[model samples]
Target: MASLIDNNSNVCSMEEEIEAEAAVLKQIQNRLAEKMEVGKTAPPTEEEQKEIDARSIFIGNVEFGATVEELEDHFKGCGEIVRTTIPKDKLTKKQKNYAFIEFESSDSVENAMVMNGSTFRERQIVVTSKRTNKPGMGAQRGRGGIRGGIRGRRGGQQTVVVKYVYVNGAAPRGRGGFRGGRGRFNPY
Candidate 1:
């Protein structure tokens, strides 16, 4: 009789715990919905507008085999495509899984934005405005950095010295010559 009572209490406690978890989950869902509503009602700021240009759209999750022609065809209804740029791997020369599409007008950007989360080549693609970096902005170049090329301090300004190294038709020759004294240092 006592064992039966204990089992009933355990079941009741389990049901109460489940109800409590469900209530918490419902609260979280409500908060998320409210936040989403707030975002939808708020207008984008001027700085954000400048950062995300009106005519450029970023397409993400592009398939490896997807071509520029296919992308143009898919977005034909949006508007006239001015240009499309798909960055490739420097060494492999393969598509980088994302592309930037520039439209003829800002209306095209708005049209494309409506197609966010749309299907493309069996995958849902993310479409968003392309963020543009202003001139003289972004990461500060380090001294002697290869990207900005060996910058030197001059008067209160930094001057970059660009050097180009060229190798002629013949193989490069070192201090020991082309073949490089192979048998000179022998280990027995």
Candidate 2:
């Protein structure tokens, strides 16, 4: 009888918790539905992006714990620092071990490039001109991941990757030959 009572109490508590969770979820769903009715903010235009890229220098091999202030201080000698960006992982929200520092003048790019391979926080950081982002990120559309076969294309240079390319028509389909007997895979 006591075990029965305990089981009933546990079931009751679980039911109450589930009802509470469903109510909270419904409230969240309603809020999201209301918000989705509004227009989303647009991304930066191409010309604006080009200007930013021209002023920006990508800082690679940055320490995970490095702050924006420290990066600005380190690169301030090059020119007037406009903005410093250290991207964070979407899920973990931690620094991605790289940063971008944008100076007010494009000329500062050369000065910052001079600091390439210099030690910063015990790590040799690479400073380079920011490469323009490929529109589709190697994908046919802006849909998902990079499609196979297309290696890369940049600065009027084309790169292709091919594997197991057979000059003849079809590959030979045959059985294998075992070592015990002269069993070798024959491509006939």
Candidate 3:
């Protein structure tokens, strides 16, 4: 009879431990859900909004060796350049073939647009106004908005499918025998 009672006590304690663990798991899941909801609904701060509204232009197809001085010289006649930013690769520290040029005023944006399709370093460059999208605002067209509408499905879950094609494995002949392949040595 004593052994039976001991077995019952052990089973009851195990059930209680399982219940406690389940409650802890439920609490963690609730906290994660709350954090996600907050992140989705939070609005941009004042500084971020100002940055989004700043008069800037995105320059694509920039030459890998292009310098900020060259960009300033190209747009010097248009208007005062407030700032310039050229994103570089993390490992290579080379230009990512794009840059952002902020002008003193919105009017300068139009002036800078005249350089669209112009040649720089033997490559035709594209210049366009830079803009940001506010959350929950849907698609806002015209100058500053992103090109085309933001495409998404319900529940905010997206699945991306990618396909890669391999070309002939030959080292491209140019620019001091730089091997042109998808690796650390290749700058392109």
Candidate 4:
């Protein structure tokens, strides 16, 4: 008799088990639907987006050989220099021709822009408010590349230089592998 009772208690029929689970799931779904009625959290306000958009001053046309120290020295007199960055080439590890400089205040940044467009060194400095470097940057150049090599339809060349390129990856047929110099990866 004890064995019979134990066996009956141990086994719940599949239909009953499924019904129990379905009921619990229904409750959870209802709760989730009710919560969703509160609506998605409103998107961030314009002011918040502006704060996100507001970036540090970006300095371009930097002399390629210029170091971080030289950049600081050149711009320090303009205002409190917060940070300076000179990006290096990916493979060569040498300085790229551009840099980014952050000032302590926006006012100082504005002043620096006014004081520094086409300012002479070896070449004229192209100083302006820092903007995202994107494909459109060349369009702003008015001709073609940075120097506006191509002429636009308006008789005067559009300074904007838009360069479009496409690359195809075709694996080499011979024993020469994709990565010859880099050896196998070993993590200790």
Clashes in model 3: which pairs?
Answer: none
Clashing pairs in 1: none
Query: What would the TM-score be for candidate 3 when compared with the true structure?
Result: 0.46
Model 4 misplaced stretches (Cα beyond 4 Å): 1-55, 118-121, 132-188
Off by over 4 Å in 2: 1-42, 138-188
Q: Which candidate achieves the best lDDT against the true structure? A: 2
Which candidate ranks first by TM-score, i.e. highest?
Answer: 2
Task: Choose 3 or 4, whichever is better by lDDT.
Answer: 3
> By the lDDT metric, which is better: model 2 or model 3?
2
Residue 139 of candidate 4: its Cα lDDT?
A: 45
Q: Considering summed lDDT, which 10 consecutive residues are worst modelled in model 4?
A: 174-183
The stretch of ten residues in a row with the least summed lDDT in candidate 1 is 174-183
What are the lDDT figures for the candidates, one per model?
0.78, 0.82, 0.77, 0.65
Q: Tell me model 1's lDDT, rounded to 2 decimals.
A: 0.78
* Residue lDDT tens for model 4, 83-180: 78888989999888788777777777776776566554576676767754444445444333334244334443334434434347543343322323
For residues 112-143, write the lDDT of model 1, one tens digit per residue: 99989999999899999888766676665554
TM-score per prediction, in order, is: 0.45, 0.53, 0.46, 0.42
RMSD of each: 20.2, 11.7, 16.3, 14.4
